[model samples]
Target: MKKPASAVPAKKRSFMEFMKRREGQRGLVIVLFMAIPLLLLAVFTYIPFLKMVQFSFFDMKYIGDRTFVGLQNYIDVFKRDDIFGALFVSVYYMGGAVVQLALALFFASLMVFKVKGDAFFKGAMFFPYLICGIAVGFIFKFFYARGFVLDSLLQLLGMEMEDIPMWLQDQRINNISLAATSVWRYTGQNMILFLGAMMSVDSDLYEAASLDGANKWHQFRYIILPSIKSIVVLNLILSISGSLSAFEPPYVITNGTMGTGTYFVIMNRLAHENQKVGLACAMAIVLLAIIILCTVAQKLFFKYVFDDGTADESKAAVRRRKMEEKAAKKAAKSGAMAQSSVSGKGGQK
Candidate 1:
């Protein structure tokens, strides 16, 4: 049986129509599957964000009557300079974050060297990351107390109290001590992240470099670093965010005091002492904005500066070539049609 002429065009649907029909059904199924979680996220996460913004505007009195004071709550913290302590504490935490990331990267690189007991060592390194933040805070507090008390062996070596700074008490030394503990605790996790990235690098690159008379340092600088450049940005963003919002370590160590710990950071100051919820929220939002800006800046910087230059430029050149080819094809098709029309007219005559 011959099919109707109208059915031929209907059967040959446009590519866009085919895609829309296929994707529409698939998208409906995906949306259905995702709907419950989306609803939960909207209710929990987005609702809280809206509430925080709402609270940023008002100062509620203990009495039932609520008065909207506009941006006064935000302004008051700056006017009093009480927020400076929070900023200080945040910077203190950031110091720890840097130390942690550096040590983690270093140790992770060592693991990638295929040392003996690699699995055991990697596990040991990552063990601390599994611990609760509050627990880490308490454990380190004890370590700080025993600072120079381990002088039995040190005494034999003629080392004394002068060698160990009063870690918990003296404000100047305390923050640094906190940073040291943080590095010790967090380095393992970072090591794992870096090690995984390092593993993905092509082994042939190392072999080629070795054959070219490149030393360990030369290979690391030229090949290893370039390959893991993306990981650096990832770790940097994580480190920066962790440092900025740091709350647990300083809060637990200082027991909410002013002088000796990361209580100087805004999270501690706002939560424990000043109770400036509005100011704290403002500080948090500002910190979040800074982190986002820095992340974007890092991404842009890495894409341009640290990228495998040849790959990006080659892809761009390829795209240009394809565009030129397409244009040439279209022009050739038009010329062929014109020639065919002229021939047809001569035959008709």
Candidate 2:
């Protein structure tokens, strides 16, 4: 008996055939294009991250003989109040990130309307982001120095130098002042991102909404927000992670002193200053896990509420299905009636 068609195995392509096809050729070229980046990503990014994870489980310094002490480093990380305290500083940074994104969105919305001198305004706003992190640190240090630029500016505004609080030395608001520097630097960058996402939204939708007598707020809530949801979520994740990894401003300006020590700053101090490499790695891993967890939670939340938590199927598809089912039932009913009528007529005759 001959084998059925379904029983036959598909022929595998030979190496020559794979190289000869246009698609295969293009894929080979694309693979080559991406090869260097993949290599660099693996070498620099993945390798180091893996090393950090490995180091977290062992008792080792940067230059000492390694000893396997599983989970002790992680335990040690949690035992220290100072480390926990430093991590708490990240809350200020996270708060700043929220305010930063808000300001960015507000400005982005304004710029989208294309006011006069928008080009100049956009450039001016974005200029701060272009400044180097170290440069911003140095600039803000001087700006915040006592009886310096900030105090002078306040004096010019009719506030006495004595009345103005010290920007960096004051423990009550030093972290906030540092966080403000970060906000100033990154808000414009975020605004540009929001602007780009907003611009990509279909203009026809906006016109249609306008025709429907929808005001700007209504259009933004209904159309703009939905369209830019992915970008906004992406920025939120970035902002959260950035806040957790904050270092430069506090590190450079305050040197992690005066209650301004952040998680990363404290980690740096441990790894380099105290030579607690394993403990630092453990802290890094813990922080990484926290960020990953938050990101995943946010993703799940956004996924669940996508499309206003309406029916899973598109409205058009749902309507079409209902129509088809109704038509089928109507046809079946008509057929049954006709058959019964014929049977009754035959019996009567």
Candidate 3:
């Protein structure tokens, strides 16, 4: 006949009680909200990254017998001249990034003030960034083709046909030409970012600077730059990282030919065309390491440069503090003079 109530009912009752509580409901909601994202991240990002790292250690193709070739792939990454040469090609892109940032900052600084056709100019600049990278690559491909848009424009300036250099074919100028495409495409983006940062700065500070006889250049140097230092640093980091991973311009425009292959393009060829998946994985890992190092170095440099006596204090912070101190001293001096004048009037009375 019916045995004594088992522990199962007791446990079920407790669980139901817990579920009925607000904390339990909140925990359940949290878990439900986090589950999908965490699952997807695990499956897509973490798993793939771990698999790539694993593949880096094995000498195996996408569909081939697996063989462990510990560290040889990594060694080859440095030993191979093509892979190393791709790194050198990145230098041109890095230089282009510097120029891109300068142009972006200059335009952003100018446009932040009242300028005619500012909206149209901003849209014209940022429009390229909104376009697909592949589309941009193709557009520049035709733009750089011999006797194309660029050449036609040059020819209109009384330049002879024989003097015009090949934009994509010549080894000396091809990389520069490709890098210029990147600059043109991305400069607008940086300008927009800098503009956003500049817009956030207090207008009163600008007025104060103007009152102090600061010219446009001085305002830009002492006020705008110090205020937007964070954004400037962020843009620099992104630009440097993008430069290292530049692929679309060189890959689509030149097909990584005539010495335009970047690290990514070379890695892509190694993985797909050559079927050296393991070595490609190693190269990817190496590139990741290099990017991390560069990012850390940049952060440290900014930190050191921006830090004054106080921890993490920026130049803008220092300037603001000095202004506050000066204002306080002026107020205190005025108050003390008023008090002394009142005392003298009382004595005469």
Query: Each model's C-alpha lDDT?
Result: 0.67, 0.83, 0.86
- Order the candidates by TM-score, highest first — what do you get? 3, 2, 1
- TM-score of candidate 3 relative to the true fold: 0.83
What's the lDDT for residue 118 in model 3? 91
* Cα lDDT, model 2, residue 298: 76
lDDT of 1 at 81: 49
| Candidate number with greatest TM-score | 3
Count of backbone collisions in candidate 2: 0
Better of 1 and 2 by lDDT: 2
How far out, in Å, is residue 339 in model 2? 54
Give the per-residue lDDT of model 2 (tens digit) for 302-339. Answer: 66665334333565764675576567657787777544
Per-model C-alpha RMSD: 12.1, 13.5, 12.2
Candidate 1 to truth, TM: 0.73
True lDDT of residue 137, candidate 3? 93
- Indicate the worst ten consecutive residues by lDDT in candidate 2: 340-349
Residue pairs clashing in model 3 are none
Name every residue pair that clashes in candidate 1.
85-264, 86-265, 86-266, 89-264, 89-265, 90-265
Deviation (Å) of 270 in candidate 2: 1.7
Ranking by lDDT: 3, 2, 1
Global CA lDDT computed for model 2: 0.83
